[model samples]
Structure formats: structure tokens, C-alpha cells
Target: MDARVIILLLFSGVCLTSAGLDKYSFINERKTWFDAQEYCRSRNGDLASARNKEDIILMTDITGWTESWIGLNDLNRETMDLYPNSWRWSTETKSRSGYMNFAPGEPNYANKEEECVDIWTEGTWSDGECSSLLNFVCFSGPSTDKTYHHINLNETWASAKNYCRTYYTDLAMIENEEENQQASSNVTDPAWIGLSRRAWTYSEATNQSFRRWWSYEPDNRSGKQFCASVYKNGFSDMGCTSKLPFLCSDGIARKQSRIKIMIQSNLYLTNQHNKDNMLQQLSASLTRAGQTDFNLSWSTLPQKLDPASLNDDHQ
Candidate 1:
């Protein structure tokens, strides 16, 4: 091949390689045990089913949380059934024959009626109630640079729009299926987004239009659902008066850092209210420097270093 042609082929190979690597990145988020499974399925993957101690620890660190869901379920409450044998993997590949590496009396099936599987800190499987709400883990296509912002309180559709505009660039908008799935992970409460039915017609919308559907389904049944968010993967016709969390985007770094400092200072003051006046003054000064929005009262400070020593000092 000519030198130029060879160089072109090498460049193309590098680009393709980068794209392929990008497709395998792991996403981290919290979801209902079932939603986690569905999220993985939607992305052509499954809930992270850890098969060994190392894998479990890695997952624990990835989530930075103690407990999360795995893809194990006891569809049949058979006590004699050994897990990894009785339980089928969510991905549905053939299960590798394995031993029930329980820690002492584990898989206790505690009630002999437990039907779900969860990983304990000991790196072993235990039976849990399937219906009980627990945080779960889901694996999917590679992660992206998508950022999320949570709205503080409920607001009218117009007010929500204005808030996002004034603070961030626009109300949170999902660009693709990956972003949509990722957004669902952060939401603990219902939130508002850029999508609306009354503010704009769905037909005139572009692919990037402010309007969005939670899951791929649009809410055409009710006259509400004029707002959107990352909490649920679908839209609901909810009244605007009903307060729910909302989403924002494009946050400034300095503002976030300042907010975090203020919160920390407030927490410190709350815990150190009985300290010396100098310390109390110092806390107040720090709070002010942080530009905290809340008031920190110091009028209740005790006059004596130790109230019990009041009589002793007088003596």
C-alpha cells in the first residue's frame, strides 16, 4: 500500500478502537432492584452479578455505598436449591456449576421463606424478600460526560423554565437513551424538566426540543404531564401545584463549592453550640465568610466555661 494510504488506515483503526472502548464503560447509579435490571436490559446488559469476592468488593467501591442490588432472585423458594445452580443469571447464559460458598449459617434463607438474593459485606449471598425495596446495580453501555443537576423545589412550568435559564443554561434535557437511563439513577423524587405539552406542541419539536418522554413513551392520555424529569423513565400528567423535585444542568463549579462549604460550616456550628465564645465567634465568622443563607444565633452561649462550676467560681 502507498505510504499515505497506510497512514490513513492506521488513523481509521485508532478512531474505531477508541469508539469501541467508549462503549464498554460502566455507569454508576442507584435504582429500585427491578429498575436496575431493566436498565441493564435496555442497554443490552444486565445487573452486575458478582460471582466472586473480588468482584463484590470492586462493585462496593464503584458505588461508594455499602449495599446495592445484584441480579439474583429466588423465583422458587426451595431451601435445598443451591444458589448459582438454583438461580439463573439475568443475562441468561448457562450457569457455571459452583459451590454454595456461604459464611457459616449464611443463605440462612433466614425464614426458610426468603426468595431474593443479595450480597452481604462478607462477600456471600443471602436470601432476601423480593418485594423489599433495596438499592440495585445495573450495568450498561459505556459512561459518558453527561452531568446532572437536581432542582430544589416545585415550581410552575414557566417558573421552572425561568429558574433553569437564570441559574443554568436550560432545563435538564435528555439527549439520548444513555443519558435518559443515567438520569433516572440520580432522582430520588419526581422532578421537573424542559418538556411540556401546553408550552409547546410536540409535532413542531426537533430531536433536541426541550420536551422529553421519561421512558420512550409520551404522556398523551392526560392534559397535565407538561413537565419532565430524570426520576422516572416516563412522563406523567401531574398537576403543577404538586411539588416535586426538578432537574437543572450546566452548574458553575465555584457556586457548588461555596454551597458545600456553607453546609459544612452550618453542620459544625450545630454540633459545637456549647463551645467557648471565641469558638462560637469563629464559627459565626466562618459562616459569614461562607455567605450562608441561614441564621446562626449565638445569644444562647453560656457565661461560664462549665455551668456546674458556677458556684465554685463564686466561692
Candidate 2:
């Protein structure tokens, strides 16, 4: 008796094609928190974004790989020297609820010129250079249409903002995902999303809204441990300089993979049976990891293995 299996991983449809969706991987390189962020973006995506339990399992699955730097952090430390003050919002036009939607590894002040935001059509957000041009969304006060208005025009963040104030109200202020949805309802493409770090807007920023903190976590020890990391069980706070291996995710493009395996039935029926079971498990794992669209098939080798070749010194 003999058995064989083939497995394939593929990306199909709009959800998987999204430019800013997260696909996670474990990195074995060690670097400080900020350094890890740079490394991840330079190579993969940003530090791993665990949007929920499923993502958390994907990032922290391999046990003993603790202290891996993630994307969340207290962003004020970098500018303590230039500003000499605590964090503050970019503008006073915030809603009473004070909702925010920053993308992972964002508002890092990575680019000195990044003091505004651009929300993509897919819903994820990122900081934008203040002078960059894009269409914008706006909302008015009680006097006018208070929902949202997508202005299709090219203008810098400052100009777009001013236009809103002059005509309707301040640029659209999104206090939560609900408002994010409401603002996006008017725009079918990317646009300025009224978010920035003018005066150190918020202390923390990341696309993920979920957290899994370790015991007594986020201690902010020594007044410098601002970045976040994950351990075997949960998360902990660390300084920007603490070097450690990290995790990352991919969003720029879709991924595809092919795997082929052969069964040596001549050895033993038990062995062949075990190999068949292993492939079944592998198929399950690929699906569990959010890989839904794929193509798979199996084919016998054109020829059986030559027994003599198994030896190192074959005649």
C-alpha cells in the first residue's frame, strides 16, 4: 500500500489582495524595539499586528520565543529632546468621545515631515507628509450635513483642512470605527483622514485594538520602557533600546506556496499510514492560518525510488 499528498497555498479575491492586510511571520533577528520596527518595515511589513486572538495565536504560537517586539508603543520618548513636553492631540477639533484609528507601527515620527494622516479605502490608516496632496473627507456641525463629505481634489493636508473649516466644518473628526465607516462611506478611494502628531497627539498608536498583557505589564519601568513585546504567555513593556528578536507581517502583496511529499511504502505499511496522517494535519494548519483559497492535487512519481540509490556509495 502507498499514499502521497500535495498541498498548495494561494491568495485569491479582494480581501487577500488588500495592500494593507496583515500576514504574520516569526523573525529570528535581535534588535531594539525601534530598530526592530525599522527592520520589519525594511524587509517584511511592520512588527506583527495582532488584531485579535487569531492573530495573537499566529504571532505567539512558537513557545519560548518570548520578548519579541511588537508594534504598540508610547511614542513620546523620541521627541522628548526637541519638544520637552508631554503628548497632546494635533488639534482641538476632536469629538467628545475622542476616538482615534492609527495603523500599526504608525505615528512613530519615523519621518520628521509626517504630521498628517491618509486613510486608505480598505480602512487601515497611516501617517502622511503634511505637504502631500490627496482628496479629503469633511463633516459639519449641527447647522449642516453632519455625516461626511468626500471632496475630490488635490491639496495638502493644511489646505484641505482649511477648506473644510471655511465651508462646512473642521476636517472630518472620526471618534471610532463607526465614524470611520461613516467618513469612508463618501470616499471610494484614499483621502486625508484628519489625524497627525503636530503636538504629540497620543501616547500610543497601532492598528490593533486588542491586547494580551503579561502580569504587572506596561510598568513603564525606569521611565523609558515604552515599547511593547510578547512573551510565552502575554505582553510586557520594554525600552526602545532593549534588543530582541521580533515578529512581522506582510501586506504589500499576496503569497503562494507549493509543497510535495512522497511516501516510501516499501519500508512499512505503518510508516506510510503515519505519513498520510501528517499531510492531513498540514492541510488543516494551512487552513487555520487564514489560507482559504488554494489549489491542491497529488501525482505519483514518474518512477519508483531505486533502492540502491538510498546508499551513500551506490554502484
Candidate 3:
């Protein structure tokens, strides 16, 4: 027997299936930071956001040993040409602008490398190199809820930011005095905060604020480092023009189905030539009927079928 598309209207219900949700995708294509972000936004969700250890691990598994672009970037001076040393938070902050608690003579840009800030034990802010291996904080949830956690792992400011975002929030933004106090309250030593100098934003918005680093990263050591890349060694600054394989994530995964066409023809249907001819006829008929978005093929099973039984009304 042969299968064919019948010219009849039918409706059927199988099972409920979701189309999409929050998830990650790994793209093996190599692109610059900006190009990768564009690719992810158009195709998947966004550039991989490994804000915590789990996120990092998941994306790392997708990346293997290759360096890949992530969402975190300090592009203020690159795109806007703003003051190189101006302070900005890691993106996705809950705090309003113009509020600061800098320690006296703090952020002196000492030795010309102190570009990131830290919340000292006294809860006051000080600027240091982005490479400093210090503990960091991650703020999860919304500003109203304001959940914070202190990470004990020593990492540089950039890595700390990535850590918080991958796992929790963006790096603790310290939305207000009370939230700030709450963030530092549980710390036994100085740690990194979400606050840093630059208009850094992830590929997409998220509530996790975590960072990890090696000894010193994102030092702008050559005065050209702007984009961020993940390495087993930790995060480091690279030029946005650098080409590297990047990570991507999807919203979620869902079920997709195809139409099942069953035939009742008594020709030489088992022959490959006959099957191909039937499929071609079905394709032409569908096109003529303005049903251009269908796929026709030979059935993979035995031939006891009914058009009425396929209809939901019959069921």
C-alpha cells in the first residue's frame, strides 16, 4: 500500500507539549564578542551566562578546551570613550546611581591598576586591580527580596562577577544601605562586590551577581583589553576583536511533532520508485492547496489505518 495526502479537513489532539523554556545552548561557531552576542540573541537566548559554578561547569562542558566569549564585558571606554577609570557596577544592579560609600582616599587608582572595587571588612569601598584574588558576593532574586551570599573561593574581580552571575546574581550590587550591611554582615574578610568601573552588561538580564578571578585579570595590561573569555585558569581580558568560540543558551526545550500520513493505496507501494513518486505527488498537491509547509514520506510501520480514526472528533 501507498500513503497519500487526502483533501479533507481533520483536527486531532495528541498530548500537550511545551515549545520552549530557560536553558543553555552551545554554539561552536567562532565570532568576536559583539558578533557572538548578536548570534545568540537572534538564534538562541544569549551568550552563555555562567554566573555560578554550576553554570560555568555546564557551559564549560559545552566548550571543551577552547576559549569562549561570555556575556560580561567592560565596554564603557570602548564604546562611549568615557573616562577609563570611572566606576560602574557589573550590570543588573538594583542600586540607584550617585550613592557611594567610598573609604577616604579610596579608589585612588593606586599604581594605575585599581579599577575594580571591594567592600572592606568595615563595609566601606576601596578600589583595587581587577586581578585581586578576593572573596566575592552574589545577589540573587529581586531588589525587594535582596538575597545575598558570600563566596569563599578566592578569585579576581572579573571571575567573581562571572561566578555570581553564573550561580546567583550579577555580583552583589548592594542596592541600599540595609542591603549593603546585610551583604557584608556575614563576611569574615574583604570580598568583591558587583560594583566595578565600566558599563559592563551580560548578554541578557539576570538576577545572579557572582564573580571569580585568578591572581589579576582584566588589568587592561596592554590598554586594549575589553572583552571577557572563560578559561580553566579563570577569566581574563581580551580585545573584542579577538575571535573565539562562544557559548549560547536557549530559553527552554519543548516537544515538536510532525504530521503522520498513512496511505490505503494498493499499487506497488513497497517499491522505492513508487514511494518516491507518491511523495512527489503529495508535495505538488499540497503546494497547489497552499499547504507549502509540510513534509511527506513513507510510513515506518505496518498498514492498518483509518482517516476517521486519526480525527480527534472520532476519538
Candidate 4:
């Protein structure tokens, strides 16, 4: 293919197949899961689908603590069977160390509204409502010194986060057993920590069996927690109406297009040199057009093919 046009001049027909490159984009606007789906569709895409670990990492790295929505959900919870399959961190910028210390039988999604988490004495964690007024702990500088400050003033989870950010670093981030113990050492009562759940699917409504759930999540305690949200580590169930940022995937990446042209030259159709030159020129043109990830392939026409049978119409 030339810069302005592609020309084929040979005895037989030549076919070129171009494969698209996949991409995942994080949309910062907050919207309900269904609304997000509509927005993505309007833009010729859909809610992002993490088909594998790489997809998950790519999408997660786009934003921090935004708790972006994914395509997985249990909208048919009443008819279709489901299970706990997700979790997240309160901070988006920091990496999750995969350390968890939930109390046994805890995180039961008490009252079916407990999405925020708190730590009690003995370093055990529990899920509770974000609006619950509780004293929270904040860490100054880094966790290296185990430097944590317990604010006795009662505040909601959101308020506590602001308070901590204004004074100390942020809400205490407990990365491991020792950090969890240190954060809880001075806690005489359950207080807010830097951990929470936002918490599903591809946007195409294709049921995917692959799941990345927290140790204990998707409890579906409310039975109405049918939607799924994503964070750093895993996914978690949330109410469908909850508005949040989301990830959208351009579906064009998975599609491959094929174009066939008739050759008019007397040279043999199997000429490797001609094929190589055509491919190099075509690849260069595509690269100049800012398309680098596409693939190209060739197919030969049948022996009995007639040049007059080829049409200019491209599929």
C-alpha cells in the first residue's frame, strides 16, 4: 500500500489482513454502572473488561482510589447464581501489599451498607458504613518508623480522610502484619484505616468465569449489591446505582479486517521480493499514520481466478 493508495499488479489476487491493537482507557467522570455503560457505548466502546491479569493492571494503574467501575456484575442476582469476588484499597496511588487481617466473621457487610473498613484493638479489621462516626488513625511521613497518630475526635470516614491528609500523611496504610499491629497498638476502639472496598465483568455482557475476589468479599450481604467495582487488588460488589469513575475499552482492537486486490502484472504471484517490498511500504505508511500495532498477512487467490472477477468494492 502506498501513502495515497494501495496498488496490486500481479497475475493472481493478493489479500491483506490487518489486526487491530487493543486499548484500555480510564474515564474519570463518575456515573452509575448502567449510565457508564451507556456513555461507553455512545463513544463506540464499553465498560472495560479485564480478561486477564495484564488487563487488570493496566486499568488499575490509570487512577487511584477512584474505585472505577468494571463490566462484571450480578444484575440477575435473583435468577443467576453469584458469589463474593472482589475487594479494593482506599488509596489508589499506593500499591497494595496484599496484606489483610479481617476478623473472623467480620466484614459481614453489617446492615448491608458497610463498605468502609476500620481496625479494632488486636489489629483485627471490620467493614462498616463510611458515614459511621469513629476516631481514625493517621500516619506521618512513612510507615518505616511505624509512626501513627490516633485522633480521638470522632469523624466520618470521608471526614477522617480529609483530616488526616491535612495534618498527617493520610489515613494509616497497614501493609503487613507488623504495620497492622502498629496501627492498632494504640486503638482502644475501632477506628478508620486506609483500607476500604469499592467494589465485576466485560461490558459485552459476556459471562466470564475468571474472577479476582478478596479473601472474603462479594458477600452480597444486601442481596441488592449486584454491581461490581474495581480497585488496586480485586473486585467487590456494590449497589448498581452508586456513581463512580469507570474504565472503558474500545472494542475495535479485537477485530481483524481483510482486503483483497487483483494483481495485473506479469510477474509470478509467489514473488517473495515483491511481497516483502509491499509489506514494508504498507507498514511504513501505517506507522506514519500513527498505527503501529496492526498486523498484516497475505493470502493467494485460487488458480482459476479471473482478474475481471475482482471488484473495487472493499469490505
lDDT of each: 0.34, 0.59, 0.65, 0.67
Please say which candidate is ahead in lDDT: 1 or 4.
Answer: 4
Stretches of model 3 off by over 4 angstroms after superposition: 1-22, 81-199, 252-315
Rank by lDDT (best first): 4, 3, 2, 1
Instruction: Put down candidate 3 lDDT per residue, 35-110, tens digits, no spaces.
Output: 9989998985777655566566665666785788887776755543333324556642224544677788766767
TM-score of each: 0.20, 0.39, 0.39, 0.43
In terms of lDDT, the best-performing candidate is 4
Q: Which candidate leads in TM-score?
A: 4
In model 1, what lDDT does residue 138 have? Answer: 25
User: Which 10 residues in a row give candidate 1 its minimum summed lDDT?
Assistant: 4-13
lDDT of 1 by residue, 175-238 (tens): 3544445544555544444332212221111111132333543343353332222222223333
Candidate 2 per-residue C-alpha lDDT over 25-124 given as tens digits, one digit per residue, 9 for 90 to 100: 6777888877877877787467765556666666667425566887766556554322212322223422455555666676555545666777877666
Q: Which stretches of candidate 2 lie over 4 Å from their true place?
A: 1-21, 77-206, 251-315
In the order shown, the candidates' Cα RMSDs to the true structure are 26.8, 19.3, 20.5, 20.7
User: Candidates 1 and 2: which is better by lDDT?
Assistant: 2
Better of 2 and 4 by lDDT: 4
Clashes of each: 9, 4, 36, 14
Instruction: Name the lDDT of candidate 4.
Output: 0.67
In terms of lDDT, the poorest run of 10 residues in model 4 is: 11-20
